[model samples]
Target: MNRIMRESRKLRSWEEMKKIILQRGSSGKDVLAPIDEVFGRKFSVIVDEMPPYISLRNGFTGYIADIWQIISSELNVSAEFQKHSFDAGKELIKNGSVDLLITPVIITTTDIDEIDFSIPIVKIWYELFMKSSDDGATSMSYIVTWSRNLWFAFLLTICILTATLWIIVNIRLRLERNRGKTPPAWQTRLDFWRGYRRWAKGPEPENTLKNELVSVSSVGSSFLFVLGALTNQGNCLKLNSPSIRTATLVTLFFGLLMYNAYSSVLISRLAVGRTTLPFPSLESVAEAKTHIICVRRYSFAYVQFKQREEDKELLEKWQGLVNEPPCLNTTSVRDVAAALCYDNTLILETPNIVAKIIEDYNRSNGCDITRLYGHYARATATVLMKKHFRYRHHFNKMYYFFFYFFSFFSMMINAMLHGGKNFERGTRS
Candidate 1:
């Protein structure tokens, strides 16, 4: 009788639990039910050797691995990570052979229909990387020492000075001729007007205004004098008028200041060994038909180049160059770095990934890589899963909760440390 009572009680307890579960399910309040269904199940995770995201060092360790650990722990699921290239991993996921892909998969329009992505874990942008070369002090350096506006101002000053000198000399000569004084030996010489007379006189009289007025040769001589002063090359022209002497003095001083400044800057630049990039902008890179444009195969960089509409012609040109001889399809960061270092290649990758590559490769290869300043493309990276993943909602929910919690925690720690340092500094002061 006691055994029958115990059996009845056990049946009642099971029935009550079943009724509770049914009610929760009907009301859509059983959030953990799906999780419970898949609890303790092992999932096959596909991963690639993407550093700081999914690395093989020490066996399945990186920021993405950490996130997976948190999500899997909350869901009570185990993951068996399999190493493969990003392309191979996508293939495996498509075939339903892998439950998840944990690399830093960038969300792009091209692949959105083919796969499902979790909430974005990180934002990234594409930057250009190229080999650093020491072609120091290029021929254009002297011209670039002064900006276009400055150079324009300098030329204007020269023209103004030349006109002033020419006018003063002409006025002085007119005064002397009016006083009935004989022309100076230098002034009487025909060489000053020789070319002008031949071009303008043909057979005209000598006393014509065109002849008596300052010859075109005088204008040329004035220009040459001003240019020579600015360049610190003294001229042999003689001036007698006080006004002409005063103008010459001003020109000499202006030239002195400009010449000194230009020389100092040029010398410092040459001494410092400043280097300039052959392709400084995206437009320049596109125009460079001889150089190869390299990017990881099947990466977002490749997708961006093909899909960008603003520079369609440039993209087409880049594609054509990439398809040509000696252009490599880089598959990894290391490969990109190697191409940048050895080949005439321009690599497109995210700033952080490029940083990692440069940091690793520059140490051994002597700092042969550099990243361009501005980014041309942007993307968000997320974990990839098979389309119609059953546990996606739960996984995303837990992932977001943990991610924000940890982010908040880190911010607080940083604030506290920064406040303490400020307090210490105040006390010291």
Candidate 2:
């Protein structure tokens, strides 16, 4: 009974000391001395494999690991890293089984209350990843060169010009008739017969003023004339009215402009070999009912999608597709890539991570995957630690220091390279 009482008292005293150390640490005092005496010089870190940020390749090496290394060396402490799934890592941190999680954790409202996050080390945005289409520049390239609205406007312009020309010619004909001008002699039946009898020996009588006026006054003839001018194929019909002549010239100029623009765009598309995607954008993806594959349930991408009120319909569609058979909740990058290449699916992830995956995959397999659509959502990523960690402030400071250092170093290197190129050019000149 006496021994039990003594042990309990010692435990109570140790707890009190830890509380005091935590208070000092929270108050911005140097509490490392107490932490060292009580906890030890080593920490246990848990991490998930997120490429370009925290990867397990070559035994735990990446941006976050490097930062952690710098901080640990500065503080003269050591860490033991263990690989685990993101969910498992979070559970460990919450239960006080781990000191830190070094994966690139996107900051979300739901996680703020459970775990603490360090200063943002990187900015990340979600993008769509899918397999590149095998067919490049499909048969519909010419038709798709101009948008539907542009085509509609072009057709409407043609109709308007045709109507204008027809109205102007009819008004001129009416005025001439009102002025008591008689039709040409060739318009009479006997004269027409005589002209047809002489057609083989002389110029055709259809070119006479009466036939020209008749053709111009007809709506179908006006439409054909306008279309021919637009296509750079001028008609043979003669127009005497100044207004009709002006409208024809305008149609010709507009046709030339539209033709040049269309030709330039088509040539570029064919030259660059732009692969047409099945669904060009997120809205189209939803409309096409393409399944979305994400790393895990409630992942950052999923969370962002859910929180966006504007994409409510998209969110519902995603939920419905994800709940179907052939589950897409995969953690392996290779599996995600395979699913994208094989199935009609799209994966959502950060640009850098997707690029890394493509680079690595292309090294082994052929180039098959590609990034589609633009960024979907932007978020800042940081390392997650246990709530109220004693070394949180210290880690944040060191991380910021190293981040700035590397950025400055990269800028200097680029400047030096550019200066060298300029100097070489001057010397050559």
Candidate 3:
């Protein structure tokens, strides 16, 4: 507030002081008491210009105004809500110009030493949104069939319906032409109409059924149904039934047992034939016997690769067999994904930077890398905070709350979208 104090503090820029007042900068001390005493009044905090905290009108802004009002009322203080760009908000807090920085701000240990924070207000979960490739390649052309197990099951049903309907139509036409009569049952007529409707409208049952069935069931069930109809009527029966019985108790029992045994073998065979299969172990990928994989340099993945001593030897052994060594190296994640786009055997590398990469890929229409590799690739977003900040406890609480909240909502939305796609895919497959 004064020239002597400003000079003694070695305040560098207006931008820094502005961030300091807002608690946005990571390099400033809390001058709240001093500022309040000197100004003889409560001061304002700097925040972003968007809603949930502060808004213009229209729809709800999630939690901004609520937080501002609560902090002000409880502390017997008032704040001037200054709207600025996200970067400017940080600058304001850095320069000791604002009293607090309140918005959905990420706080980490590195950030604590510079400026104090209140409890974390909110947290976020991230995901990758990719333009799906047919054969795991970058483009769609390489995809021969996009079979979701659910879709396959549905397709099986369509096939059975089509065949049974064909048989009925033949019978009906023959009876009408020769015997000059309708089919014996009305159910048969209904079946005919249903099949006709499907044929006319396309293979899908109808929008209403699609929405209802897909919403209620898991993708796997839908797939089983489709597969059952396409391959054989008995397929669905076996999937739905744990056991079955027949009239010729002894002979029928043996026959059913044999059918079950054969079906198991056939199912395994079908699973093997599909192009999209579970990835082999990192050891296997490292071996480069029949495939290639991209991994980050000096990263946990690279470390793991090294830890698997046998796998390392295998890579060296196979290096001479290929036209060139299959090692693709790059720092940028997008570039690595691009490399994976064209290479059939290559799997791209993903490091522990989930939120940042997910947001980028989603906005950029890049690689679909949502298929996480278990604990091996868990990336966490952390807040960088400064040391000795007065409000660490307050910030941590807010941060944790947001972390869980955003993660839950984000996953829910993803699951909803995933279910729709999975249903259609499962049915076709």
Candidate 4:
């Protein structure tokens, strides 16, 4: 009982000492080093397999490795490196097998329960990966121009209805039935409108005729009405039935709206040709029926899909893409990106990571990854540490030091080393 109390007292005193050390650590005292050295302890960092960010094999090497080297140097301590896969790294950090993670992990809700993160080390953008543009105009070009499949259905309904009208008019003509007089040969536009106005107001009854010519004239009127709504022309023949006129008005209304929408979209697309931009969005991806190749599970791309529980269509696409043997290599994301060099590929990945992959790729293949959308660019990604990590404050202080002073320099140096791939942060396509 006495020993238990004494041990508890020791734990309290250690916590008090840690608090004091953290206070001094941030105040430019380098106080953490003395404690770490006195305890003969170092942080173990689990590094994941992202090159140009953190490459861990025989030893740590990459942008993150260089940064960690500087941080360790400044802290007057060394971090032991343990190379692991991304999921394994997360599990290792969560279970306290490691005190730190060299891999830059995105801060997520799931992570909140398992680990603590330093202040953001870097910001990464999300991208919608898609295939190279194809120049051919398809029968589906109306999709881009109309922006909805319902419009196509509506137009098709109009065509079918018009054809039915034509057939009915032909049958009536063959039966030699007519109840209206034919228009004068030299009738003006005003005369046609005058006659239509009378018909809609319930025209006076007159002598009926059973004639094939009247049926032919009705067929001509049906064609005229269809042409006026679908194109820039109007039918002059007045329909006698109230129901038929209402249906014609419905067709005209839809036709007017569709014509305006289609014309505007078509002109814009023509201005910026399809070759310049194909598959502008996920909807386009579905319409184009392009193959989906995802890099890894729990990646930012999948995270976005998970967040969009309401988007049933996109969710379905995501599920379908996952059901195969290595639509992508599950281990290395870079390998999936490298696959883009040959296969028609659209892959969702963090922009900075793939930008490096593309840089390395273009050196040999002269290929490029097309970005259709940028997601999660503002998400905070930081170094992961074990849950309730004793030295979180200490590491956070060190991270802030690097973030303010070295952050800009690191980005500049990277951009200089590789040509400028500096895209604006957080802009969605």
Candidate 5:
């Protein structure tokens, strides 16, 4: 490449070309460097098909894209857009398939070795999302509870077990009137009622009920004990049989845990006034009680955070939290908002995606989303270019100094040119 460049430079007077550029500056066609003039019909870029950024339909609606159009017009060069992925654009820059990438890709430490990036174009902020309260036409008005399907399943299970217990006890009853035994049918029925009453009320059956009978069937007591324990308001029903007592103790322990969980979830939801509760911060999200099915693309705060900050405690905590897979991995950030479409889910993504979602939902129910945590870890998206490209410094200077820094001046000049053209057209008519 050096040999070819030397041969090329020999043909053109490099000194004279430099003098012309110095006089005219970037404002005139004479300022085009030998490198710029080499094969330049139009300076085209490999545009990644990220809508609002670069697309056939949107053309270049994003702020950075608008800025690019301004720069292109200033240089008196037409920009031809070619669509490609970020990876493809990087590869193109490496092999010189394209001059540069127009789409703004976030500048990360990992990318530094491969390609040089232009001056930071747009400042980006990270955001999170949860389902809106007004998700449906009629918002959910019920207290926090498990889904109806779960309740149905539990009821079905209980019914089947209770029926089986009744059948078994009836079949096992023995009627032996010869040895001071009552008729099996009457005795089994009486015992079941007495035992169940004892369990539902208390071991002091006389106090729980005005009248009491001597309990016989331990099976009835066991069944009633399990049911009452589930509500955490069980009677002090102690079984004489060791197995029955042990089972009762076990059920009570599990019931205590379940009831506590249920009550806390209901109370918290009531306080929040929504099924989904607001988290204190991004870190608090990890410990949030709401079991939301989160979804995200690669452009997420957690990914950036884990990659950059090496705080062992934080990394370890986040790593372990995501192990349960808080958010489903997606290829596009737009799809991350799907998490917010559901009942209990969240998305950790950039503000661009959040704005897009809100725009789509504007006329309808309106996005019930809130920022909650922050515009944390402010970042910049930049244009990707070949490492040590001849025009890197010029491109940076063009935006930071000429185009972006003098944006107000450029806008006025553009408006004046547009107004003059319209007036000329009117005069021609």
Candidate 6:
């Protein structure tokens, strides 16, 4: 009872708590030395299997390691940072095996319940990377151009509808019993529109000629609407501007809209049954499940890879090749390559170590294990804490501070790295 009271009292003061923790060997300080030396006792930290940590030569070796050394020296503590798989890291913290967690720690409530954390030492950004050999970088402009293939798709839909409608109209005119009686073209157009409206708003499936004609006419309406919206000609008075040039621009916009609408229909008809970009064939061990490595139950590229039905089918098809995804050999990215079995050639990995990996491989000119498909999922890193830690306030302050600093730098650095005069010089084919 007295010991319990003493422990309660110890937590009341920050210095007393620190002194008590030091005696127990847990230092909340971010440092390089063993935990005992830093806290004046003994302590352990749970870290994810990320490289340059402590196990390998390149493990957390360069600038980051140096920074940790500075922090270690300043705090005068010996800290033992242990590496584990992502899930294992959580388990270690939950089981009270570690006093703190510090590898690219993402702060969250669940994490706080398992382990304590010091001030966030660094910020990590997750990004998508593709092969550099593919001259086009993955950027907003690239995505727009690639997927604006939507315009072509829409145009195709219009063509099929228009042709179907014309055939039906001509057939009905020929079937008319009285040769002298004929519906005007505009009347026929209005009838098509009415049929279209009914077909769209009516039952689940409409199979009659009227429904088919309606569907065709609706397609035309959609083409015109998209064209008008894209060119900003559908709303002229709303775009009223003072400059005489503005009126001229508006007229030009209307002209462009008409051209685009006509051309879209024409192209859709011509390009029927064809696509410019072929579905990349599934070849090589990397494309097969035999060589792909992902952490157990931990989603890496799983979601993104699954999104492509073809990729998912291939994975299922080749699942026989991979008996099981090997336990991630090490958390550090550099060591990760060596752990891959000869049969395994691909590691579904995080987006954050891309630049370093690229630099390393370029410098080595060896086997390449560093290409990414697309973004999988987004999840923030959080620290795990034991129930008694009671250090939520400390972790939150550190997280917010680290988040602000890194986010600012990430934006600035990303812009600088991905954009320049050279980036702007490219022309679309």
Identify the candidate with maximal TM-score: 2
What RMSD does model 5 have? 21.5
Clashing pairs in 2: none
Encode model 5's per-residue lDDT on 1-429: one tens digit a residue: 223222223333434333333324434443435335422346658876554455445456666777776666555557677877666777887777677787645545666777788887776776666666553222343432556685686567555544543343333332211323334776667799765775688543222111111242355754674567778778444434344445556667767876787677666656665533456466576676454434332343545546463332335545444423434455454445445555555666666656765664333324467555576445566788877776777677556644323433332233344544443343345
lDDT on C-alpha atoms for all candidate structures: 0.66, 0.65, 0.41, 0.59, 0.54, 0.43
> Which is the better candidate, 2 or 4, if ranked by lDDT?
2
Question: In model 1, which residue pairs have backbone atoms overlapping below 3 Å?
Answer: none
- Give residue 293's lDDT in candidate 4 (0 to 100): 56
lDDT (Cα, tens digit) per residue for candidate 2, span 89-185: 8888888788888777554666677798888877767877766665357788878777789999989998998898888878777765554444477
Q: lDDT by residue for model 1 over 1-429, one digit each (tens)?
A: 223222223333433333333223223365455556667888888888777666687887777778777557655689887888888888877777778887775546656667887888777787777776653478877877777899999889898999988887787668655654444777757566874565586653344332333452288888888988898897545544467668778888999999999999888877876555566666787786657777775566665566452332435556666524444556776676666664566777787777666665553554556556677666567788888778777677656655544543433343344544443343344
Candidate number with the higher TM-score (5 or 6): 5
Going through the candidates in order, what is the number of backbone clashes in each?
0, 0, 73, 5, 1, 34
lDDT score of residue 356 within candidate 5: 66
Model 6 C-alpha lDDT per residue in residues 161-277, reported as the tens digit of each score: 345434544444344323334457888687997757756896544335444334433445434533454455562222112332243344446547556765665555344422122
Best by lDDT: 1
**Native RMSD of candidate 3 (Å):** 22.3
lDDT of 4: 0.59
Tens-digit lDDT string for candidate 4 (1-429):
222222222332333333333334334354455336323357787878676677655467777677777667655676677777778888888888888876655557656888888877766666656455543255456565654576678667777868766665555555543435566756745598887887798957643433323643565567667768767566543545444556567667766876787788777766654534455555565566556556555454445545452332446545555313335554475565655654555666666677767765443555544666645334345788889988777677666656544323433333334433331121111
**Model 3 / residue 266 / CA error / Å:** 4.9
Q: In candidate 2, how many Å is residue 20 off?
A: 34
Q: What ranking of all candidate models by TM-score puts the best one first?
A: 2, 1, 4, 5, 6, 3
Model 4 per-residue lDDT at 27: 46
